[model samples]
Target: MLPPRLNDGGRTDLDLATLRRATFGLKLGAGVTLISLAIVEKLANPEMARAMLEQEPLLNLLAPFGVSADAFAVVAGSVELLLGLLVISGALPQVVAILTAVPFTATLALFGATEFLGHLPLYGVLLSFLVLGSLEETSHSLSGLRRRAGVPTH
Candidate 1:
Protein backbone atom coordinates (compact mmCIF):
# COMPACT_ATOMS: atom_id res chain seq x y z
CA MET A 1 0.00 0.00 0.00
CA LEU A 2 1.05 3.59 -0.52
CA PRO A 3 2.42 5.50 2.45
CA PRO A 4 0.13 7.87 4.36
CA ARG A 5 -0.08 11.44 3.10
CA LEU A 6 1.10 14.50 5.01
CA ASN A 7 -2.06 16.41 5.54
CA ASP A 8 -1.68 20.15 5.26
CA GLY A 9 -4.85 20.85 7.19
CA GLY A 10 -3.27 22.55 10.20
CA ARG A 11 -0.93 19.74 11.18
CA THR A 12 1.47 20.09 14.08
CA ASP A 13 5.20 20.76 13.77
CA LEU A 14 5.66 17.30 15.24
CA ASP A 15 3.35 14.58 16.48
CA LEU A 16 1.83 15.47 19.84
CA ALA A 17 2.15 11.94 21.22
CA THR A 18 5.72 11.71 20.07
CA LEU A 19 6.61 15.01 21.66
CA ARG A 20 4.96 14.10 24.95
CA ARG A 21 6.73 10.75 25.22
CA ALA A 22 10.11 12.22 24.35
CA THR A 23 9.63 15.01 26.84
CA PHE A 24 8.99 12.48 29.60
CA GLY A 25 12.26 10.71 28.90
CA LEU A 26 14.11 14.03 29.01
CA LYS A 27 12.44 15.04 32.23
CA LEU A 28 13.41 11.77 33.93
CA GLY A 29 17.05 11.68 32.87
CA ALA A 30 17.83 15.31 33.65
CA GLY A 31 15.93 15.12 36.93
CA VAL A 32 18.09 12.23 38.11
CA THR A 33 21.28 14.08 37.29
CA LEU A 34 20.17 17.19 39.14
CA ILE A 35 19.05 15.25 42.19
CA SER A 36 22.39 13.50 42.35
CA LEU A 37 24.32 16.76 42.29
CA ALA A 38 22.06 18.42 44.82
CA ILE A 39 22.66 15.53 47.18
CA VAL A 40 26.43 15.71 46.81
CA GLU A 41 26.77 19.47 46.99
CA LYS A 42 24.06 20.33 49.47
CA LEU A 43 23.56 17.30 51.68
CA ALA A 44 27.08 15.90 51.91
CA ASN A 45 29.10 19.11 52.34
CA PRO A 46 28.36 21.60 55.06
CA GLU A 47 31.51 23.53 54.34
CA MET A 48 30.47 23.84 50.75
CA ALA A 49 27.11 25.14 51.85
CA ARG A 50 28.79 27.75 54.01
CA ALA A 51 30.99 28.67 51.13
CA MET A 52 27.95 29.10 48.91
CA LEU A 53 26.49 31.61 51.35
CA GLU A 54 29.78 33.36 51.83
CA GLN A 55 30.35 33.56 48.12
CA GLU A 56 27.33 35.75 47.64
CA PRO A 57 27.06 39.00 49.51
CA LEU A 58 23.35 38.99 48.83
CA LEU A 59 23.05 35.56 50.38
CA ASN A 60 25.23 36.54 53.31
CA LEU A 61 23.01 39.52 53.92
CA LEU A 62 20.24 37.08 54.66
CA ALA A 63 22.30 35.36 57.34
CA PRO A 64 20.52 37.45 59.91
CA PHE A 65 17.72 34.97 59.39
CA GLY A 66 19.82 32.61 61.50
CA VAL A 67 20.08 29.82 58.93
CA SER A 68 22.91 27.37 59.19
CA ALA A 69 24.68 26.27 56.06
CA ASP A 70 24.02 22.59 56.72
CA ALA A 71 20.37 23.17 57.41
CA PHE A 72 19.96 25.38 54.37
CA ALA A 73 21.79 22.91 52.18
CA VAL A 74 19.71 19.99 53.44
CA VAL A 75 16.45 21.71 52.74
CA ALA A 76 17.40 23.30 49.43
CA GLY A 77 19.23 20.30 48.03
CA SER A 78 16.60 17.78 49.11
CA VAL A 79 13.87 19.90 47.59
CA GLU A 80 15.77 20.24 44.32
CA LEU A 81 16.34 16.49 44.13
CA LEU A 82 12.73 15.72 44.93
CA LEU A 83 11.35 18.21 42.46
CA GLY A 84 13.86 17.16 39.83
CA LEU A 85 12.71 13.55 40.13
CA LEU A 86 9.11 14.54 39.92
CA VAL A 87 9.63 16.77 36.89
CA ILE A 88 11.90 14.45 34.94
CA SER A 89 9.92 11.28 35.66
CA GLY A 90 6.53 12.84 35.00
CA ALA A 91 5.44 11.51 38.37
CA LEU A 92 3.57 14.75 38.49
CA PRO A 93 1.42 16.25 35.72
CA GLN A 94 2.60 18.92 33.27
CA VAL A 95 1.30 21.60 35.63
CA VAL A 96 3.54 20.39 38.41
CA ALA A 97 6.44 20.18 36.02
CA ILE A 98 5.96 23.80 35.04
CA LEU A 99 5.76 24.85 38.67
CA THR A 100 8.86 22.85 39.55
CA ALA A 101 10.80 24.44 36.72
CA VAL A 102 10.19 27.90 38.16
CA PRO A 103 12.57 27.40 41.05
CA PHE A 104 14.92 25.31 38.97
CA THR A 105 15.05 27.98 36.31
CA ALA A 106 15.66 30.68 38.86
CA THR A 107 18.43 28.62 40.35
CA LEU A 108 20.05 28.45 36.94
CA ALA A 109 19.56 32.16 36.37
CA LEU A 110 21.17 32.85 39.69
CA PHE A 111 24.17 30.76 38.74
CA GLY A 112 24.41 32.35 35.34
CA ALA A 113 23.87 35.77 36.82
CA THR A 114 26.52 35.43 39.51
CA GLU A 115 29.19 35.23 36.86
CA PHE A 116 28.45 38.85 36.01
CA LEU A 117 26.59 40.28 38.99
CA GLY A 118 28.90 38.81 41.61
CA HIS A 119 31.67 37.52 39.35
CA LEU A 120 32.13 34.47 41.52
CA PRO A 121 32.58 30.81 40.59
CA LEU A 122 31.26 29.36 37.35
CA TYR A 123 31.27 25.58 37.75
CA GLY A 124 28.33 25.42 40.10
CA VAL A 125 26.26 27.72 37.96
CA LEU A 126 27.16 25.85 34.81
CA LEU A 127 25.94 22.58 36.27
CA SER A 128 22.75 24.19 37.45
CA PHE A 129 22.19 25.57 33.93
CA LEU A 130 22.65 22.17 32.36
CA VAL A 131 20.03 20.58 34.57
CA LEU A 132 17.71 23.54 34.30
CA GLY A 133 17.87 23.66 30.52
CA SER A 134 17.23 19.95 30.24
CA LEU A 135 14.25 19.96 32.54
CA GLU A 136 12.79 23.12 31.02
CA GLU A 137 13.32 22.04 27.45
CA THR A 138 11.65 18.70 28.09
CA SER A 139 8.32 19.89 29.43
CA HIS A 140 8.27 23.13 27.49
CA SER A 141 7.84 20.97 24.41
CA LEU A 142 4.13 21.31 24.94
CA SER A 143 2.77 22.63 21.65
CA GLY A 144 0.00 24.91 20.58
CA LEU A 145 -1.43 27.84 22.46
CA ARG A 146 -4.76 26.02 22.62
CA ARG A 147 -5.62 22.35 22.81
CA ARG A 148 -6.62 20.81 19.53
CA ALA A 149 -10.08 19.38 19.24
CA GLY A 150 -10.65 16.41 17.05
CA VAL A 151 -11.58 12.76 17.25
CA PRO A 152 -9.77 11.81 20.48
CA THR A 153 -6.58 11.56 18.43
CA HIS A 154 -4.84 9.19 20.79
Candidate 2:
Protein backbone atom coordinates (compact mmCIF):
# COMPACT_ATOMS: atom_id res chain seq x y z
CA MET A 1 0.00 0.00 0.00
CA LEU A 2 1.17 3.50 -0.76
CA PRO A 3 1.88 5.67 2.23
CA PRO A 4 -0.75 8.43 2.62
CA ARG A 5 1.99 11.03 2.83
CA LEU A 6 3.42 9.96 -0.55
CA ASN A 7 0.08 9.27 -2.24
CA ASP A 8 -1.52 12.63 -1.66
CA GLY A 9 -3.38 14.01 -4.71
CA GLY A 10 -2.06 11.11 -6.82
CA ARG A 11 1.33 12.87 -6.88
CA THR A 12 4.36 13.00 -4.65
CA ASP A 13 5.33 16.13 -2.76
CA LEU A 14 8.97 15.04 -2.90
CA ASP A 15 11.25 17.18 -5.01
CA LEU A 16 13.25 14.79 -7.16
CA ALA A 17 15.72 17.39 -8.41
CA THR A 18 16.70 18.20 -4.85
CA LEU A 19 16.90 14.50 -4.06
CA ARG A 20 19.16 13.98 -7.06
CA ARG A 21 21.48 16.77 -5.94
CA ALA A 22 21.64 15.35 -2.44
CA THR A 23 22.47 11.89 -3.80
CA PHE A 24 25.25 13.32 -5.92
CA GLY A 25 26.74 15.09 -2.94
CA LEU A 26 26.65 11.88 -0.92
CA LYS A 27 28.18 9.87 -3.75
CA LEU A 28 30.98 12.38 -4.08
CA GLY A 29 31.66 12.34 -0.37
CA ALA A 30 31.76 8.55 -0.30
CA GLY A 31 34.18 8.59 -3.23
CA VAL A 32 36.53 10.98 -1.51
CA THR A 33 36.46 8.96 1.70
CA LEU A 34 37.21 5.78 -0.26
CA ILE A 35 40.13 7.42 -2.03
CA SER A 36 41.57 8.73 1.22
CA LEU A 37 41.23 5.38 2.97
CA ALA A 38 42.74 3.53 0.03
CA ILE A 39 45.75 5.79 -0.09
CA VAL A 40 46.36 6.08 3.64
CA GLU A 41 45.50 2.61 4.90
CA LYS A 42 46.15 0.28 2.00
CA LEU A 43 48.59 1.87 -0.44
CA ALA A 44 50.68 3.90 2.01
CA ASN A 45 50.65 1.80 5.19
CA PRO A 46 50.32 -1.64 3.63
CA GLU A 47 51.82 -3.56 6.49
CA MET A 48 49.41 -2.10 8.98
CA ALA A 49 46.52 -2.76 6.58
CA ARG A 50 47.58 -6.37 6.26
CA ALA A 51 47.82 -6.71 10.03
CA MET A 52 44.30 -5.39 10.39
CA LEU A 53 42.93 -7.75 7.75
CA GLU A 54 44.65 -10.71 9.42
CA GLN A 55 42.10 -10.73 12.21
CA GLU A 56 40.53 -14.16 12.85
CA PRO A 57 37.43 -15.18 10.85
CA LEU A 58 38.17 -12.71 8.05
CA LEU A 59 41.57 -14.32 7.52
CA ASN A 60 39.91 -17.71 7.53
CA LEU A 61 37.42 -16.52 4.88
CA LEU A 62 40.27 -15.56 2.58
CA ALA A 63 42.03 -18.90 2.97
CA PRO A 64 39.72 -20.90 0.72
CA PHE A 65 40.29 -18.39 -2.09
CA GLY A 66 44.08 -18.72 -1.71
CA VAL A 67 44.31 -14.99 -1.23
CA SER A 68 46.65 -13.72 1.44
CA ALA A 69 45.49 -10.75 3.48
CA ASP A 70 48.30 -8.66 1.97
CA ALA A 71 47.28 -9.44 -1.59
CA PHE A 72 43.62 -8.91 -0.80
CA ALA A 73 44.35 -5.55 0.78
CA VAL A 74 46.32 -4.34 -2.23
CA VAL A 75 43.77 -5.56 -4.75
CA ALA A 76 40.80 -4.29 -2.76
CA GLY A 77 42.53 -0.95 -2.27
CA SER A 78 43.24 -0.64 -5.97
CA VAL A 79 39.60 -1.41 -6.76
CA GLU A 80 38.48 1.16 -4.20
CA LEU A 81 40.74 3.77 -5.78
CA LEU A 82 39.39 3.04 -9.23
CA LEU A 83 35.75 2.99 -8.12
CA GLY A 84 36.26 6.19 -6.15
CA LEU A 85 37.63 7.96 -9.20
CA LEU A 86 34.78 6.71 -11.34
CA VAL A 87 32.22 7.84 -8.80
CA ILE A 88 33.73 11.31 -8.39
CA SER A 89 33.93 11.73 -12.14
CA GLY A 90 30.23 10.88 -12.37
CA ALA A 91 30.94 8.14 -14.87
CA LEU A 92 28.20 5.51 -14.83
CA PRO A 93 27.22 6.29 -11.25
CA GLN A 94 24.52 3.63 -11.10
CA VAL A 95 27.03 0.95 -12.05
CA VAL A 96 29.56 2.34 -9.61
CA ALA A 97 26.99 2.37 -6.83
CA ILE A 98 26.15 -1.29 -7.46
CA LEU A 99 29.82 -2.22 -7.48
CA THR A 100 30.37 -0.34 -4.23
CA ALA A 101 27.49 -2.24 -2.66
CA VAL A 102 29.21 -5.60 -3.18
CA PRO A 103 31.99 -4.89 -0.70
CA PHE A 104 29.57 -3.30 1.74
CA THR A 105 27.27 -6.31 1.58
CA ALA A 106 30.21 -8.70 2.00
CA THR A 107 31.45 -6.78 5.00
CA LEU A 108 28.00 -6.80 6.53
CA ALA A 109 27.67 -10.51 5.94
CA LEU A 110 31.07 -11.14 7.49
CA PHE A 111 30.85 -8.76 10.44
CA GLY A 112 27.07 -8.85 11.09
CA ALA A 113 24.75 -6.29 12.73
CA THR A 114 27.24 -3.71 13.95
CA GLU A 115 28.60 -3.23 10.45
CA PHE A 116 25.05 -3.17 9.07
CA LEU A 117 24.08 -0.30 11.35
CA GLY A 118 27.29 1.54 10.63
CA HIS A 119 26.76 1.28 6.88
CA LEU A 120 23.08 2.25 6.84
CA PRO A 121 23.82 5.80 5.71
CA LEU A 122 25.98 4.56 2.87
CA TYR A 123 23.32 2.08 1.91
CA GLY A 124 20.75 4.86 1.76
CA VAL A 125 23.02 6.96 -0.42
CA LEU A 126 23.60 4.14 -2.84
CA LEU A 127 19.93 3.23 -2.87
CA SER A 128 19.00 6.82 -3.63
CA PHE A 129 21.38 6.97 -6.58
CA LEU A 130 20.09 3.68 -7.89
CA VAL A 131 16.46 4.67 -7.54
CA LEU A 132 17.01 8.15 -8.91
CA GLY A 133 19.17 6.96 -11.84
CA SER A 134 21.00 9.60 -13.93
CA LEU A 135 20.81 13.12 -12.57
CA GLU A 136 20.81 14.49 -16.13
CA GLU A 137 17.60 12.76 -17.07
CA THR A 138 14.24 14.48 -16.73
CA SER A 139 12.57 11.14 -16.28
CA HIS A 140 14.25 7.92 -15.20
CA SER A 141 13.15 4.29 -15.06
CA LEU A 142 11.40 4.72 -11.76
CA SER A 143 9.51 7.68 -13.14
CA GLY A 144 8.59 5.60 -16.14
CA LEU A 145 7.25 2.96 -13.82
CA ARG A 146 5.17 5.54 -12.00
CA ARG A 147 3.82 6.92 -15.26
CA ARG A 148 2.83 3.45 -16.36
CA ALA A 149 0.82 3.16 -13.20
CA GLY A 150 -0.88 6.51 -13.94
CA VAL A 151 0.97 8.31 -11.21
CA PRO A 152 2.50 11.75 -11.57
CA THR A 153 6.26 11.65 -11.13
CA HIS A 154 6.40 15.30 -10.17
Which candidate leads the pack in lDDT? 2
Residue pairs clashing in model 1 are 27-88, 28-88
* Candidate 2 positional error at 144, Å: 21
What would the per-residue lDDT of candidate 1 be over residues 1-154, giving only the tens digit for each residue? 1123478664545454566555555555666777777877877776787798778534433357986666677777777778765655454344554555555455544577654454222233234334434553333343211244673423
- Residue 148, candidate 2: Cα error in Å is 26
Lowest-scoring 10 consecutive residues by lDDT in candidate 1?
137-146
TM-score of 2: 0.67
The C-alpha local distance difference test score for the whole of candidate 1 amounts to: 0.54
Candidate 2, which ten residues in sequence have the lowest lDDT sum? Answer: 138-147
TM-score of 1: 0.53
lDDT of 1 at 46: 66
Quick one: best TM-score, which candidate? 2
